[model samples]
Target chain A: MKIVLIGSGNIATHMGKAFMHTGHQIVQVYSRTLANAQALAKLLNSTGTDSLEAVVDHADLYLLAVSDAVIPEVAAQLPQELEGLVVHASGATHIDVLDKFRHAGVIYPIQTFSKSVDLELTETPFAVEAREPADTSTLITFMSAISNRVFEGSSEQRMAMHLAAVFANNFSNALFQVAYDLLAQHDLPFDLIRPIILQTAEKVQNNEPRAVQTGPASRNDQNTINKHLQFISSNPDWQSIYQKISDLIVKRKENNSEN
Target chain B: MKIVLIGSGNIATHMGKAFMHTGHQIVQVYSRTLANAQALAKLLNSTGTDSLEAVVDHADLYLLAVSDAVIPEVAAQLPQELEGLVVHASGATHIDVLDKFRHAGVIYPIQTFSKSVDLELTETPFAVEAREPADTSTLITFMSAISNRVFEGSSEQRMAMHLAAVFANNFSNALFQVAYDLLAQHDLPFDLIRPIILQTAEKVQNNEPRAVQTGPASRNDQNTINKHLQFISSNPDWQSIYQKISDLIVKRKENNSEN
Candidate 1:
């Protein structure tokens, strides 16, 4: 399968490598910055271009791995008569953003990608959606070649999944940052909490997160909560976060008990 | 070393098993309830009792593995002239809570423990603190037998570490619970986000968490943030959390740029 990668960002670099590893031909790579396109193309042994007109129109797939805000602008740049299945690798953007193409779809790899990190794509789940049944099957085949986990879902489900990912990955990491900063303020090394962070993530794999939740908030220990709130009083932002999240946990526990 | 475990809760159970595994002699287990103590004692091949007076006085160490609120009460119950080094396995409670003892210390393992989950304690870091130099060395040797990672700090440092753990372990798990609940509401399987969670945690081991943070919040993508806020409008608690955390992330990012 000949593929044209539409961006040279972190997601694009990872998806491009995964596609190439699966024996697919990356015929062209495009980026607004010529250097990045050329760098990725050099590694993939593909043509690199900064202009959408230079994209190979006859490739089997055109993967738009750009940011959510740029999906429309990038899609508008493609030749209106291009002959390929056009797909965007965004969880938040709706597939309708690709409606300019005759054949449009989405192949959202539901994992955070970092250019320096070598991720194992085989187990990473891909959420696929296409305007037509045949296109959906093509996406399934394309994605299955790179990953073992693939599921069909609508834009609503994908967006919901993206929101959940934010909570699980981004928001959780933000909370970790909070912990890191707190420890740093006290001259405590971040290593002090690394084991606990790893263990907390490991526990959720087999147990329900709610069942495994442990802390003052879960126990409704107001005294400790008040002490923590007082400790972070200097930082109003953290104070609000601590209070809000604690309240949410306590409320959820109460609701569960009432049920 | 002869040891007496003075609680039958989750931490006590895990600590008892770890001590027994290291070939230490768990001479007695004491709890407010005889049955609870006996249940754990039976597994460690030791005596169990409800009365504090029945606790073995000549043990090499007395481990107070009770709740933070009950630490003082339990410490008061112990015979004032007891001959063993006394330690409390608590993060929030200070070593001073056991001031009644001639020799007091702390053996706070910095991980969330559950009796159902078999944790590998050898890699889990233990934070040790003691009033005397010899007792600190004794505590270090005992902790080193069960874990390769051990550090010494003051009671103030332990409380701070405990607060950090709440953020790293408890608060992060709460964020996960939010994601789990969100996924459940959408009729999506929790498995969809499992890989992402594991990868997110793994990324932090090698990178600064602040550098690795990604999401609508970190990106300051207000468009997606507003969309998510609208999606969760029915749940005000989630809405407030979404707003507050996003605000915090954006504020932190802006602060970073200024610096």
Candidate 2:
């Protein structure tokens, strides 16, 4: 398949590099910034263009690898009625945003990416969705060719999965930031908690998170909870966040008990 | 070292099993429930006794592996100071809780344990602390025999580490429950987000989480935030949790930028 990347962000850079080992051909790259476009284009030995009108219609797939808000605007400005499928690599945006194109689909790679750090994308799950059934199958097949964990889901599921990832990955990462910051204030190394953090993540790999919940919150130990709360009293926002999460755990425990 | 575990819960059971291969001898196992005590004692080929009066003074280490609230009560009932060190395997409890004894210390295993799963105890981090410097050294040496990751910390640092862990492990586990339940409502499998969760944890192993934060909240993208909140509006508590955590990320980002 021939491909054209429409943005030079993390997703675009990763996908461009991943396609390097595959049978696909990357023909053109486009970005609002020419240098960003040229940087990724140089990796694929492809042409770079800052003008949306200059996007080539020669590729089999043109990925709108841009932000969610501008996906519609970018799709609107692209050359109309292209011969290839037009897909966006967004977890939140709907496929109808590209309705002007005869071919519309989505291929959301469900993992964090940084250009400096190469990824084992072959193991990353790609959520593929399309407006038409045949288009969905085509995207699934292409994704399967490069990765082992490819699944076809509804646009709603893809969005829900994204939301869940926010809690599972993004929000949890924020909590980690809280831990890191608190430890730093105490003059303790983040390395002190690394092993325990690894074990916490490893636990959920085979067990349900609710079943394996631990700590003062899960145990409903008010003494420890209050102790922890008092310890962080100086940070009112952190105390609130602590209380909310702890309450969620306690409430869920009660719900399970009633059932 | 000669050892006796005072409680037959997850901590006692895991530590009892971990000590079986070492040079240490578990002289006795004590539990409020006779059967529970005998069950763990049977694993170590040691005796099980329910009465504190029957506890032998032959062991060099007495581990009060029980709950935070009952630590004082349990410590009060234990046989009066012999020639052994009395320590509690609690993350939140202070070492002075055993003030009635000659030797008081803490050996906190900073990992969640389930009776059904066997762990690689050697890799687990044990935070050793004590009321006296000599006792602290003893704990550091004993813990080092069973695990490679052992460090001596002040009681305050241990308590702070426990508080940090509430945010790192316990609160994050609660967040994972939120994600799991949300996905179940959408008829999505938890497996879909497993890789992302693992990657989220792995990134922080080498990088500060604040530096690698990602998500709509980190981006301060109100559009997607409003969309997610609307989708989960039926559950007010979840909506609140979502708002608080997202606000936290946005605020932290603002702080870093200001710095």
Candidate 3:
């Protein structure tokens, strides 16, 4: 099926490339910048269009892979009599936001993406929703062409997933920053933590993370905990974070024991 | 080299097996329990002993792979006229604690170890230190046989690495627990987040995690943030964690912009 991707940002760049590799025609690429649109369009062998009106061309799906703030306004700009099924790839934005389109749906990929990222289809989770059963099926089938796992989730469920992604990906990445800062302050090379970080991630795939949790906080090793607390005492923000997360871990372990 | 392993725990079991696989003689396996010692000892065709005195036979190295608190007393129990090098594998414990022995060193593997985890050689980093230069060389050579990467890190550096490992491994795993809890509370399978978790981990291996940060907190998507905060408000601990981590991300972004 011919697909028109309506954004030339990170997600669109990677997703469009993945789709192209799978032998799907990316019909057109639209972005606020003609240069970006043309660049991605050229890569996909598709036409470039900065104007939303220009996206009325031939395509089976129009992926509104734009920012969350612009999803509704972008939908309003599309033709009232649409030529194809329209979908936006926003995770937090609701399904109803796409209701203005004659045929509308969502294809939210739940993964952290960037242009430099070389992604495989199996690594991406496509969370889709649609106004009608056939529309949903159509979107799922089209998505399954390039990806094996496609999930049917409600807008509310998708929102929950979006929040959870923050905890698992974005927030977890920030914690990496915290670790970097703490080590840097001690004049330690950030590279020393790299191997352990990779191993930590690998461990979860084989076992539950909680059962594998080991540290001053996990062991309730007060001596090391006190030392770390004193080490980070200068930074009140990190200190509070350390204290709260530690308390939470202990509380959760206690709760689990009760069960 | 003949190695006498003390404590038949996770690290001991794993390292013992690695040594046995490398065709090194594991002279003895000592633990609190005869059965546990026998089980691991049999794998390497070595004697299992509950009595530490009886097990301190003719070996080139005595590797004390035991709990952090037990190292000192264990070292004290050893006879003064020893004929082998002595070392403890506790990351947080000081190498000077083994000063009672004429020849003492450390062989601290920087990766998390479990008896069940089959570690790839190139992936593990070994941090070694010793009072004498020859001792360090012997330990480094022994470790290099089992691992590809070996670095000379002082006990201080290893302790710092151990602390950093807590943030990288334990804290990250705890965040995973939070992700699991948030999903489980909403009647979603913890499995749904597995792929996302794996991808998040993979991204950081070759790239800076700070560079790939995303989601509502990173974007400062106030609407979505407000909605998630509302949803998690009932769980006050999670609510605090969510708020603090969000604030940290936003603050860090601001800090990066200034620099």
Best by lDDT: 1
* Tens-digit lDDT track of model 2 for B1-259: 7899899988999998887787778999999899988988999998898888888987899989888889999888887756799999887888888888888889988788877667888878888988889988888988887999998877778788888888999888888888888789889888878888888888888888877788889889898899899888898888998999899999988988999
RMSD of each: 1.3, 1.3, 2.5
Native-referenced DockQ of model 2: 0.79
For residues A202-246, write the lDDT of model 1, one tens digit per residue. Answer: 999988889888888998988788878878889998889888888
Which model is ahead, 1 or 3, in terms of lDDT? 1
Across all models, the iRMS values in order are 1.0, 1.1, 1.8
lDDT of each: 0.89, 0.87, 0.81
Query: Candidate 3, residues B125-217: lDDT per residue as tens digits?
Result: 788899999989988888888988787888777776776676677777888888877777767766777777878777877777788788777
Which DockQ-derived CAPRI band holds candidate 3?
medium
**What lDDT tens digits, residue by residue, belong to model 2 across residues A78-111?**
9886989999988887788898998899999889
Could you give candidate 1's per-residue lDDT for residues B1-259 as a string of tens digits?
8999999988989989989999998999999999999999999999899999888779989999887778888899889998999999887777788888899999988899888888889888898999999999999988998899998988777778888889888888888888888888889988988989899889998887999888888888888898899889998888888898888899999999999
TM-score of each: 0.98, 0.97, 0.91
Q: How accurate locally is residue A238 in candidate 1, as Cα lDDT from 0 to 100?
A: 88
TM-score of chain B of each: 0.98, 0.96, 0.93
DockQ (CA atoms), all models: 0.79, 0.79, 0.57
Error (Å) of candidate 2 at residue B145 is: 1.0
lDDT of 1 at B3: 90
Q: Cα miss at B244, model 1 (Å)?
A: 1.9
Q: Looking at candidate 3, what is the lDDT of residue A72?
A: 82
